[model samples]
Target: VQLMLVNLASPVGPPFALKTVTPSAFIQNMLQSTEERLNNTTEVNPPRILEWFDMSNTLHQKFSLIHMERPLFQPFPSELVFQNFTPLQTYKLPLILLNNDKVLRHVKLEQQESEDFFVVGPVNSGSKVAPGMSITFTVGFTPKENKDYEGRLICVTERERFEIPVRAIGPRAILDFRDEIFFPICLVKAFTQKTHLLRNIGNSQAKFKLHTQRPFSVKPSFGTLDVGESLQVTVSFHPLTVGDHREDLLLHYHTGEDVFISLCGSCEELDIHLEPECVTLKRTYIGLTNVHTVSLTNSSDTTLQYCWTMWPIQEVEEKNSVLLQEEKEEESKGQRLFECESSSTAAHHYSVQSGALQENGTTINCFYIFVVQKGEIWPNTTAQFSIVFKPEEAKIYQHTVYCDVTGRESNLPLTITGEGLGPELELSYSLMDMNNVFIGDKDQYDVQMSNVGFIEALFRFSVPDTTFGRCFSISPVEGVVPPGASQNVKVTFQSSNLGTFSEDLLLNVNGQPHPHTLTFRGCVIGPTFHFNVFELNFGDVAFGFPATLTCTLFNTSFVPMNFSLRVLGDGSGSQSVSSSSQVSNLSHKNWKGHAARVRPVEFTIIPAAGSVRAMSDVNIKVTLCSNTVKVYRLALVVDVEGGQTLQNLCDPALSSEAVSREGVSFLHSQASIDADSLRITLHLPDKEPHQSNS
Candidate 1:
C-alpha cells in the first residue's frame, strides 16, 4: 500500500508538501534506523506525524496517524547531534533522550559497554514517552583516563534501535595549593617572610602566575608545575605603619583557573620600661647605709642592653640681693644661678653600693658600679639591683641616678635622698622631785643639758605661765652648748602655798619641733611639833620579871607646855592599864582587879604632871612588872594640857630596840603616835614551858 506523509503539527514556516511511499520500504527504513525502539519485534506501524489537539475539547480525536517529511521526523540531524562530549575529569555528564512524536511511543535508552569506559544505566530498561516528553537515561559520560574516552548511548524501540556516540576528555594541568591563607606579624620598619606551596594535582603540567599587593612581595611570580609536583612561593611582608595590613595572593593558571591566598600581617612598636620607673633610697642616718631595690623589665620582642650612672645633684645658694632690673632679667631668663659654693663636694658624703649577708653569715657584696657597662636582658624578663646610700653630713642631700639602655634616646632617672642628724640635747633627768620644803621656803636645784651628738646644741626653754611660772624660775633659759659638753641650768622654786606643787619644765632644742618636758614636785609645811622619839621597843623580859626603859620627850614649840602621862595596855595582855582618872581615884584598883589572873604592869613618871619650857626636853621612866608568863605592852601618852595636839611623832630617830640577854622568853613592844594618842604594839612569845607546868 502507498502511504502519503504530511506534517499537520505546528511548523516553523510554510507547511511541508505531502510525499508518497510504500509501506514496506518505510517499515524497512524504520527497522534499520539507529533511534531507540520500544520493543525488539519488528511489528510496528509506519512513521507518522499527528496534529496534537487540546484534550480539553472533547469533540476532537485523541489519536491519529499521518506521514511526514524527513525533516519533520528528525529535528536534529546526524551532523548536528553531539557525537563527542568532553567534560572535566573531576565530574560526569548525564545522557538524555527526547521524543518529538505526536503519538505515544515506547523506548529503552541505555549505554553500550566498552573496555575504555563503562555505562552506568541499564540497556534493557524501558519507558513510555508521550508527545513532547523528554526522559533522561541512566547513561552518563565519565572520563576514566586523561586521554580521550569514547562511549555510545543506545535507544531501543519495537521497530528500530538508535545509537548516540559520546567522547570525553579528562582535565589536565589543574592547579592547587596547600594553604588558602597566610598570616604573619611584622615589626615596624622590619619584614617577615613566609613560603607557600603550589601543587599540580592533575595529570599534566600546569603553568601559574603569582600576584600580590604593594609592601607584599612574592618570589618566583610565574612558574610551571608538573603532575604531582609542587612549587614553593615565598612571600615577604614589610609594613611601614603600626596596624593591620592585608593583601591578596593569587595564582593564575594558563588554563584560565585561579587560586587565591590571603596575606595578612600586623605591625607594632617595641617598648621596654622599668617596673617603678624611678627608685627612691630609704632614709639613712649619718655614717649609716640605706639600700633600695629597683627592677628593670623588657617588654619588647628583642633583647636589650642597659647601663647606668649616678651623680650628686647641684644646688645654687643665693647670697647677694638682686636689684629690680636684675630680677626682671632673671625672670625673663626662666632661671638664674647665683655665685655660691658648689654642691659637688657633697658627693663625697654619700656612697651607693649593693650587697647583703647570706644565710651562712658571710657578706656577699654585689657593689654597684658608678658607670655600668652594657648588661644584656632578654625579652619579657626582669632584672633587679640595689642602690645603697650612706650619708656623712647632717643636711638633706639628693643625688640623681641615670639608667641608660642601648638605642634609647634618654636615660631613666632615679632619686637618692637622705638626711643626717646633728647634735641633740640630752637632759640629765627627764623628771625630778624637790622633796618637801616648808611653806614660804625657797629651794634651788640644777639640771644638766648635755650635747650628745656631734654638733653644737642650741636650746630655748619655756615654762607654763600658771602657778609654776610664779613658783619656779630657771637661769640661762636659752643658750648654746658645744658638742660633748654639758651646761647646767639652775631651777629655783619658792614655795608660796602649803599644799603639794608640781610643774613640767619644757626645753625646746633648735631645729626640733617637739619640746622635752622635765617634771618637778615639792610640798610646803606649816607650824608643827617635833619629837625626839616616836616609838619605843622594849627588849625581852623574863617571865614573872619586870623590865624598864626611858623615853625622852622634846618640845619644839616656842611656848612652855604642861604634860600628863598615862599608860594603856592591849586587850591580849593579862595586865591592863587603868584609866587615868580611875587610877588616880583608886591607885590600887588595877592591881586588885588582876590579882587572880596576874599582876598588872606599873608605870611612873618622875613628875606625874609637869611643865617644860620652850625648846626644852623632859624625861619619863616606864617600869613594867608582870606575874604571868606573857608579854605586856602599855601606851605611853604624854599629852600637853590644853595645848595644840601633835600627830605623827613616830620618828625614826626615837625608835629603839632591846634584846633579851638572859635567854628568857622575850616580849616585843613598839609605839606610834597619832594626833590624839600613842599606839603601842606588843608581841608575846610562846608561853614558857616552866610557867605552863607551874
Candidate 2:
C-alpha cells in the first residue's frame, strides 16, 4: 500500500498532511508536486527576526529569534529591555535589527505610549530594510514622573510580526556647581569670605554636604537643592599665619558624587619698625625739659594702625638711709614709682611729655599715650614723634615704649634714656683776712669752695679793678668741683704800697643764679726796725762769774737810723756807767739831766746804741753777772730815732701802745724805745753738791 503526507503552512490547520497514492509512479508525481509547492511557499514568505542590538553597541539575546529548535517562551512580555533607566526621565537608544533575508522588505513600528519615545531618521513609523542588512532606528524615551514604565513595540513585516519590550525610568537627582575652584587673598588674623553657587539641574531635589580644611570654613555646609534651583554657599578663610595657604572644599551629594573646589589664598603680616630703635635725650637740668624724636615706619604691604605707651620709669633712690627705707616699703607692696622730696613734700622724680592730635587740628600735651590713627601710616611710609623728658632730680633715667596694633598680637619695643642735672655751689668762708702785711711782703688767704648739689660745679674767680685787685692774686682762676667735694682757692696779697685795703672776691659758679662773694681785708706797712732775737738768755752762769752775749738789731727802714741803748736790771742796788754813755750825754746836753737812773748791776750794755745804714744790721754786746744762785732778768732798751718817716706812712689805727713796746714798731716820737729783756740763771755749781755726796 502507498501513503502520502502533506506539510501545510497555513495558520488554520495542522503542520503535516497525509494522502493515498499508487506505489512508485504516484509517489514520484506526488513528490514533484510537493517540491513545487514548497518552493513557491518559500519564495513568498517574509524575512525572519535574527538578533537585537541597543545604542550601547551591545547584543541582547532576550528578543533573539534565532533558536527556533528550542521552546519559544517569552520570559518578559516586552522584547526590548532597559537595564538601568531612571524613572520620570527620557532615555535615548538606537534600536537595531540583524536581517538575514535575501530580499528587501518594508517594516512598521507601533507602540501604545507613542508620546514617551521618539525615533530619528526616515525609519520612524515605517522603514525599508535591505536584504542581509541590519534595520537600525534611533528611539528616544522621556518620562514624566518617577516610576517604571513597560510597553511593547510591534515591528510588522509582510507575513510576520515581532514585539520589542520598552522600559523607562523617571527623572533622577543631579548636583552641579558653577565653578570648580576659587582663589582669595586674606590678611593674617583677618577674616575673608567668598560665595560659591551650587546648582541642581535634575528634576528631583538633591542634598549636598560641604567640607574643608583648617582655617577654612564653609557656611550652609549641608542643604537641599530643589529641582532646577541654585544655592549660594559662603566659604570663609581665616588665616593664622603668613605666606601662601591652600585647602580643599568638597561638596558631597546624596548620590555618592563629590564636587571639589580648590581654596587658595595668601596671608600677609603687617610690620611696623622704628628707626634707631631707641630714643635718647640729652642731659637736661633739673626742672627743665629735653625733647627727642623717634621715627616709625611701616614695612609691610598694607596700612597699619599703631599705638604706643611708655612704661613708667623706675625710681632711682638716693643712697641716703631715709630714702632706702622708703624704697623697701614700696618694694614690699610690689609697686614702683619715682619719688622726689622737696621741702618735706613728695614729688615725682621724672615726667614724660608727648604730643597728641586733637579734633580741631591742634596738638595737645599727652603725658603717656602716643598713637597714630587708623589709616594714618601707609605702606613704606614713615612718621616721627617727639618725647620730652623732664626730671625733678639728678639721675640717669631709662624707660621702654611699646607700640601695638589695635587687634593684633604683634608689638614693638623702644627704649628711652636721659640724664638729669642739679647744680649747687657753696663757699666755705664768706670772708678772709690776710692780717698785717708789710710793704714788699706777700701773704695768702685760703678760701674753700664746695659742690653740695648733685652735679659738677664750675667756678671762676674775679676781682674788681681797685687797690686790692692790684695787690691780691688768686691761685685757681677757674676750676671744677664735683659733687660732695671741696676745693681750696688761695688768694695772695703782695704789694709795694702801704695801706689798709679791702676787696670782694667773686665766684662765678656754673648754673648759679647769683655769684658768690668773699670779702678780703689786709694791711700793708712800710719799713721798720726789727730785732734778730727778742730776748737774750745766759743760761747757767756760775756765781761770781761774768757772761757776755751779743744781739743783732736790723734797720728795715729805707733811711739811715741812729739808735741809743740803755740797760735796766731787777733792782740789785748796783750801778755802772759805760764810756759811750758820756758821749751820748754830750750830744743831747739839753736833756742830760732828765735821764732816769735805776738799779742795773747784773747786766750791762758795752756799746750803748749805734748808727745803722738803710737795710743794714748792728750787733750789741751785753755783759751779765750773777752773785747769787737766783734767776735774774734785765731789759735792754733801744731807741729808734729816724723811723718817724716810715711811721707816718703806716695806718694809725693799726698801731697800738702795746705794739710799740716790742720790736718791729714804727714810732712817731723823736726817740722810740723797744725794751727787750734777758734772763740769766746761776745754779751755784751742782759740782759742789756732787763732791759732798761722794
TM-score of each: 0.25, 0.27
RMSD, each candidate, Å?
27.1, 30.8
How does model 1 score by TM-score?
0.25
- Candidate 2 residue-wise lDDT, 185-295, digit = tens: 655545566776766766567887776765576777678878878888777666545678887676666754455666778776654467777877788876667766678
lDDT of 1: 0.51
Compared with the true structure, all predictions reach lDDT values of 0.51, 0.54
lDDT of 1 by residue, 141-205 (tens): 34443454556655564334555555443344655553335546555434567776656666567
In angstroms, give how far residue 477 of model 1 lies from its true place: 0.6
Error of 1 at 600 (Å): 48
